[model samples]
Target: MSIQMEDCLLSYKTALMAVGAAAAYYIIRWFLWQLTVGDYDRKYVFVTGCDSGFGKLLAKRLDSLGFHVFAGCLTEKGVTDLQTGSSGRFKAILLDVTKSEDIAMAVKIVKENIPPGTGLWSLVNNAGISGPLGFPDCFTRKHYEQVLDVNMYGVIDMTNAFLPLLREANGRIINVASVLGRISIRTCIPYTISKHAVEAYSDGLRRSLRSQKVSVHILEPGLFKTELFNLDLIMKNIYKDFDAAPAETQEYYGRKCLKDFTWVVKLMGFASSQFHKVVNSHVHAITAKYPKYRYLVGYDAHCYFWPLMYLPEWISDFCLDIEFVPPAGAQKKKNN
Candidate 1:
């Protein structure tokens, strides 16, 4: 009878231990969630490229969550839309990312608008350009330079201009990079190169700011439905410039290249989203107490692309090719 009683006592103790462990896990999980979501009250954030896409949606989300949002757009129409749609929480400012003068004006506005001691809490470097799409060999020096000016140098100038404010507030810098930054694909060399540069810049900045309490985060989103994939615009531009090609260039690729290219471009448009996933990742990175250094946003980003980042370049290329077919009726060319 005593042995049976002792066995019961052991079972009771095991049950109590299991309950304690489960409770501890719950508490830890709650703490982590809180840490990641952060406090949304009274914080201020600045976002660029508010004209459309992720920037517009992110600005709205942040403003709705009670953040003071300073949204920058390149055009008057964008400014009007943001001002009209949002409550008094958002202030739309005109900013052409490539223009230093516009950048200066934006900085001045931020200094004047944000109350003294409030500082500029976060700078979302969401402004970027996806330059002309074609084979890497097809791109000219001018095209590469133009893309770098807007995508790479523009980011650098903005960050430098706003560094003082960010330092004062001990806030975060969220750069909207791309999965292309981590993995290069065919026919997107200019954009891929620029994004790769951005990744390096963000990493260097993160390490440099470690001692200063400033956090740097990168938002690496896969494909999303946006004006970037406007089929009509792409075809119009390509056709308009087709005659400008050298005689040799025309002979090499032939007319079928353009048709196939358009098909693939249209396919990408259908595959991506009208509603971008980058906005959620951007908000979390900006507001979270301990924001992760890098966030891979989009369904395919985490599921497919990111894992391939670890593979050899040839393997990655093979994997990407299988997933994305070349434009219809365009055969793979033989090496010279």
Candidate 2:
């Protein structure tokens, strides 16, 4: 072979070797990650938002794994749904995470149910609200508070209330954030803000609680086909916010424009139907001998949003803005 051809062949061989090494490393890592703490009998798990979605699924999954599950539901119907045809090990607690009284009552209930001297193995803070969808300027303080109450404050309160129990068991605390937490978008302003708070809180918590042998894990899941992602419900919220805006603001962004924007949002249907990925992350956080501090669930979360977060702000902003259709009567369009 000519010298140039020989060098090219060597480069290819070196690249192949590097690729092989990476594959081998990941294969070994996967096996190591499979190590789990297997005593399910004495372990008890508590999950919030069992009314539907991930909370309900996780509670049921843990119950199936033979752990006593304390499923917290906001409504009587939620409680009933989880209890009906479920294993006796599943204890449904009427919990409204936003209410201090309800949280206190839940603490009592969890304590009463778990065996004395045994601590809770996991406390999954899965309750969250999508909040009202609107342009950032359209939202009032109340709109932000409503989401923060459940998504941020609720997580804090639950973690604090359950810390003692978790410490006793050297347990895990799993808080559900979102891919939007890492990167902000024009939509779901309140929800994104709350999740960012969750990410911060979880990190601070993990570091502070290290001495106590309590681990905190944050789950950053992309949009999923959950009740929170219901398009009709989202549209209703958007309309409500739009109507509530000032007349001048309404005129600036006409209803037709708003509708078109929402239509664009609908077209970008990135919500994954595979709910198991999130549930599996929760399970690993709870049962693994060593769990990741942050679990980025779903391809959108792992491959898209997470990577976007690490890019330059201008670049990320450009990429995210591609999906955003300018509303009717936008000043920029008028200028154009």
Best by TM-score: 2
Q: Residues 256-304, candidate 2, lDDT per residue (tens digit)?
A: 7787778866854667888999999999999988788889888888888
Task: Give the total clashing residue pairs for model 1.
Answer: 1
* Residue-wise C-alpha lDDT for candidate 1, range 13-65, written one tens digit per residue: 99999999999998986676467434555677889989999999999899888
Q: Per model, how many backbone clashes are there?
A: 1, 1
Question: How does candidate 1 score on lDDT?
Answer: 0.81
lDDT, residue 141, model 1: 91
Per-candidate local distance difference test:
0.81, 0.89
RMSD, one per candidate, in order: 5.4, 2.9
Error of 2 at 292 (Å): 1.3
Worst 10 residues of 1 by lDDT: 327-336
Top candidate (lDDT):
2
